[model samples]
Target: MEIKEHYSLKEHHTFKIPVQARYFAEARTADEILELSRHPAFRSQEKLVLGSGSNVFFTKNFEGLVIKIAIPGIEITKRQDGYAIIRAGAGVNWQELVDWSLQQNFAGLENLSMIPGTVGASPIQNIGAYGIELKDVCEGLEAMDLESGEIREFTAEECRFGYRNSIFKNELRGRYAILAVSLKVSDLSAPGVTYRPTASYGDLKTKLEAMDPKTLSPRLVSETVSEIRRTKLPNSTLLGNAGSFFKNPVLAEERAKQLIKEHPQVPWFKDSQGIKISAGWLIEQCGWKGKRVGNTGCYEKQALVIVNYGAATAKEILAFAYNVQSSVRETFGIELAPEVNII
Candidate 1:
């Protein structure tokens, strides 16, 4: 592992925010990560672990050791009870895993297609879409504790997943660097055996049916979900963005009823806690949708996405987000929390 000084972060992160890291290194193996953990700079300086850097925003340059997880591999480790266990290296692109699972006739993970990040980030974010989340198929994970430099394992229950959240995002945040992820998917090797896919969420069912395929499969679901995302969200390559900027705020039962009574037209659905209000619809109600300030704006198609239209400074983008949050709070008395981790 070669540690570099003053590395530009504009390309590392999807936001394309022009910033630099004081120190940077890429680890492609478990041993390399252990070695770096013992390095003098790692022991002395602050550290930030990155995986594709898709769900983060930086207000200023990170003056710390940025360890980019680049480890790569994917394989079906075992199969039993009609389920196949697929293990993927942390740095493997999330979309590629979904595609691989489908190609190998393993069922599950179709609804999560097009999510921009790596397997290492899946558990950290508990990424979800179209009625499915990473927690649904995740069997376990392995990570190297930065402080101990010892490899440890965690089961699905230990992850404590909850709607784009996990223990990794909370109590264990930054405590360890993920090395690999294991997923349990249905085995479809037998003839006449088909796995029931997730297609009931949003317009997924309708879109999938419109395709009019001979039968439903993981590949079909993946393609339909990918198509929907391509239409609703902007491509980070064409336009710098981190998908949804804010999460749908969940309110208590009584509070949700009150809000529904006041603004009955606003979109919402039942959440695990109570009612989940749509952040995009709320921003639109506040007249921030499609509104632009300098080089940043809400994407014209989806208000949930905050796009940096070439050359926007990190502070400018942050200020624009603050303005949106303020408007939502002022109008609906609802506090909109950002989903992206701001550093």
Candidate 2:
């Protein structure tokens, strides 16, 4: 792996934020990652492991070593009891793995299809959509402790997954580099395969049924979800963006009840911790949807997405987001938290 200095980061991230890294390198295997730990700068320089840069917003140039995990491969290491354990490299594209799983008739990841970033980043964010979350299918993962150069395996339970959160984001943040993730998926071709495709969340049922597929299968769900997303979200290639800038605020049951009573039009879903209210609906109600302010603004199609019209600095993005937050906090007595990692 070649390490470069003062590297331009414009192409690495979907946001297209014009930023540079003081030091940058890509690791294609676990050995390379351990090699990175032995580098002279490893112990002295601030370090960060980056994936596809799909879920981060660089507010400024990073004055640290940025190690990009590029480990690759996807294979089923175990199959039994009508199920199989598929292990994927952290560097593998998330959608590619999803498509592969579908092609092999492995069921589980269809709902998470089209999500940006790499497999290495999945467990970090506990990525989910429609209904199923990564925690639901993840069997385990192997990560190298960047500090010690020792590899450790983490079970799904040990990952401590919450809504869009995991232990990787909390107790273990920045300490380990994910090398590979293993997921258990139902073998649809096996006799008496009982895995049922989920298409009941949000408008999924409506759209899936509209397609009129004879069998509501993983392939159909993947395509339907992708189609729905394409219509609601702008392509990052044309417009710079990290999808869903803010998370749907999870409100307590009583607070949710009161809010629902007061604002009957706001959409919501139940969460294990609380009631997840639509951040997009709230932002739209605040009149920020499609309202471009300087270089950044909420996307016209979905208020949850903040887009860069042409040139947008990280400071400008933050300013616009802060304004939106102020409006929401003042109007609804709730604080808006950003989902994107601001750095």
Candidate 3:
């Protein structure tokens, strides 16, 4: 619990934006977090509970304490008839967890491979890709109340998981520090049992078409998804980006019908809300793809991603994103909301 004053956050965030935190500290255990919370500086200051800092942006210097969650470990806590409950520490790398599960013959979490950030941030963001979501495997979670220092547990239903949303990101935002997550992963080696694999989303169908379905496993699916993601998204460490800067907007059925009539080429998929339009497609239609504005620009391969060319400030990125947003709105009459959490 060594708290430092005026810590540089350039290396902490995926965007690599240069910003300073008034105070910064790392906690590897629940007791350490409680101790830091009791400190005079933390008691009176605003605090940000951070993981690997992959899903956040710094619009300016953080004015108060930034507590980086570093708690660690992964262990099987319970076993059912055909599946097991695994508890992972908040600090565990998300992709590492997926790889470990595959090695252990777990059938879930393969489609979520290569996602950036720590386990602690997964539930909050409801992180998803290739037709699979965290909520599908999550059993429960443990978190510490920031003010009371009391640890609490929540079931998946209690978390209110939504598309890229959860109670942790809304009602309980800034209120709790996640300690661990409990996931129910299938035991693929279980006798007379086989868990269905997710391989129909995006290009996965084409990728898996030549493979034997009987031989399909979590490891294979994980590898396939990893390759797909690598081809589409740039490495954040090298290019300085948080993937998919904007959320795909969902519109009512009537609104979607209107747009489809206006632009016959528009792509969409059916959802509970209505129709989910492709944010990337919309941005590309606005002529922002492969486009650069000073130090900030849209990724050439993926229009939804905003990249920092070199030493780009937070303001520059924000302005560039706003311009894209305005263009999309003006052209399509749909407002795009940012997926990146701007600090």
Candidate 4:
């Protein structure tokens, strides 16, 4: 629970934004978090629980206590029938967890491989990729109530998972810090067993067919997803940016049909809520792909991603995003919402 003052947050976030936190500390356990919450320095101030900082954008210096959650460990606690329940400390790197699961012959999470951030943060945004989401594999989670200093457990239903949304990001936002997460993974003989006879998603299916059978295992799906992502999305470590800047706006079926009538080539898919349109396609259609504005720009390979070319400020990034949103609104009549957490 060592706390520092005027800590630089430039290296904490994926965007590499040059900002400062009035106070900063890393909590390695739930006890440490409780101790920090009671400290005089944090008791009367606002607090931010941060993970890998992969999904956040700081628009200005935070005038609060920034608690970086670094709790650690991974354990297989129970096995039943054909599934194993694994528990991981909130600080576990998400990508590392996926890789480790594969090495142990665990399936289900292969589709979510290559995604960024920490295990604790996965449920907050209901992080997903390919055709799978965190909620699909989550069994339960443990968290500490910041105000009460008491730990609580939440079942998957309690999380109220939605499309890139959850109670942690809405009803319970800023109220608790995720301490650990329990996931159910298949103890299968191979990685892609559940996804056979063919991959579920179209792009993945195409890639699998193109690969040699010897390489077409559960690990292959993860490897292929990683390869596709590497070619499409910029690595935040090499280029400063958060992946997928905007949510694919979902509209009522009728509205989606109306838009499709105007632009017959528009791509969309049906979801429980409504029809989800392709945000990247909209941005690209507006002609911002590979376009640069000062130090920031939209990634040419994937227009849904906004990048920092050199030292772009939060304001610059916001302005560039605003222009894209306005263009999409005027052209498609749908408001684009940010996927990244703006602070």
Candidate 5:
């Protein structure tokens, strides 16, 4: 592994934020990662594990080593009860895995069609979109302990997934490097179209009825998901963004009921703790959509997406996000937490 000094991170991250890493190394295999952990330069310094760098905001130059995970491979193995297990290397692009599953007629990841980032980062947030989450299909993951360089496998339960949270982002934060993830997917067809975009566009029951159980096509689901996401989210090539900036805040039932009394049209979904309020709706209610500050602004199409119009600095983008958060909180008495990890 060739470690470079003063690496530009502008192009590495999807936000296109101009920032520098003091030291950088690309690890293509598990052994390479272990070796890097032993390096004196990395041993005593704060280390950042980088995947595709899609879900992060770099406010300033990093003072430590940024280890980019570059390991790549995918294997499909047989599992019990007509299911198949998919093991993907951490460096594998997330969308490519979705496409591969479609090509192979595997049926679990269709709803996550256009999400950016790498396989290694998916479980860190237990990423979800449409109607499915990574945890819904996750079987296990192989991760190396950053301190000892010893590899350990964690089951789904061990991950402790919640909305935009996992053990990797909390208890085990910065302590483990995810090397590969194993997911169990069905060979036999099953369709999940309960989410808004899917339900509005596809006739789920009708499509399922038409497909022969013995020879169902995964592409049917994948294509439907792709079409919906393409229409919903801005193309990253055209506009730099890391999808939604904030998580939809879940309010206590009593708080939601109080809000309902104030604003009868407020939309919500029941969760284990209470009701999850839509962040987009909250922002739009606060009148921040299409609001621009310098070159950074909220997307005209998606209230939740903060965009870099041309040359917005990381600081400017974050300032804009803070303004949105402040406005939403003042209006609704709800605090919006960022989904994008601000580094």
Candidate 6:
């Protein structure tokens, strides 16, 4: 719980954006978080909760306290009726939890592999990918109200999850800090193979049949997912990135139909509300793939990912993102919002 001033945030975030935190502290336990809430300095200023810092872009130096969550632990509790409830600390790495779930023979998080960030941040954004979302497996979560230092539990419904959005990013915004999350996983293999990549591997039955039914293995699923992710996303170690830069824009049915007439090759998927068009496809069609301005560029293989080739500033990257957004909007008349949080 050592508080440091003028801390470098380059290593903290996946984008490798060079920014400084005016004040920073690592909370190893819930008590430390509670204590900090009562501190006069923290109370007077704004606070930022940082996990692995994967889903955030630091545009400039933070003027307030940056609480880096370092709490750790994963406990499997209450196994009954072929399901097990697992509680994980907020600081636990998201991918590690997915790996752990597979190791314990629990099925549910296999589809969301290789996503960057921490367990606590999952519920905040209701992170989703490849036809699966955090809310689908999340049972509940405990968070500390930063103002009152009181712990509160939120059920799945209360979280109000919707396409990379949750209560934490909306109504609850900066009021609370997530402490831990409890998830329900089942022994029965309920594989989600509807996504194109997963389905291309094989049908659900074929993939499951390959595994040993008598003895379940989470490792196999993790490995498969890891391999798939590696093939698609740029490795953060080799190239600086935060996966997808913007969310796919959802269009009204009539507008989607009009666009379909114009671009016959455009790919789309139907959600409950409307049709979601592929942002990557839109960017690629706009000729942004492999386009670079200084050290920042759009990935050649995946147009959705904005990469830092070498020395790139946060402003430069953002400028490139805005250019992409402008192009997409001009082409489709739809505004694309960034998925990464900019601060």
Q: Write the per-residue lDDT of candidate 2 for residues 1-343, one digit (tens) a residue.
A: 8999999999999899899999999999999888888888667788889999989999999999999999999999999889999999999999999999999998999999899989999999899999889999999999999888999999999999998899998899899999999999999989999658787688787887676566678888898889888899889999999999998899999999999999999999998999999999999999999999888989999999999886999999999999999999999998888888888
- What TM-score would every model get versus the actual structure? 0.97, 0.98, 0.98, 0.96, 0.91, 0.91
**Best-fitting candidate, scored by lDDT:** 2
* Native RMSD of candidate 2 (Å): 1.1
The residue pairs in collision within model 6 are 102-218
Per-residue lDDT over 1-343 for candidate 1, one digit per residue giving the tens place of the 0 to 100 score: 7998999999999898999999999999999888888987569777899999899998899998999999999988998777899999999999889888888888888888899999999998799888888889999999989998989999999999998789988999898999999999888995656678777776897877676566777887888888888888888988898888999999999998999999889878787878889999999988888889999999988999999999999999999999999999999899998899889
Candidate 6: list runs displaced more than 4 Å: 188-219
Model 2 misses residue 305 by how many Å?
Answer: 0.5
lDDT of candidate model 5 versus the reference: 0.85
Candidate order (lDDT): 2, 3, 4, 1, 5, 6
Provide the clash count, candidate 3.
0
Give the residue spans of candidate 5 off by over 4 A: 189-217
- Model 2, residue 90: distance off in Å is 0.3
Q: lDDT tens string, model 5, 165-227?
A: 999999899899999999988765434322112332233434545656544456666676676
Q: Check candidate 4 and list the clashing pairs.
A: 192-218
What are the RMSDs of all candidates, in order?
A: 1.4, 1.1, 1.1, 2.0, 3.8, 3.8
| Candidate 2 accuracy as lDDT | 0.92
Alpha carbon deviation, residue 193, candidate 4 (Å) = 7.8
C-alpha positional error of residue 61 in candidate 1 after TM-score superposition, expressed in Å: 0.7
For candidate 1, what is the TM-score?
0.97
lDDT of 4 by residue, 218-243 (tens): 68888888888888999888889988
Number of backbone-clashing residue pairs for each candidate, in the order shown? 0, 0, 0, 1, 0, 1
lDDT of 6: 0.84
Looking at candidate 4, the ten consecutive residues that score lowest on lDDT are 189-198
TM-score of 5: 0.91
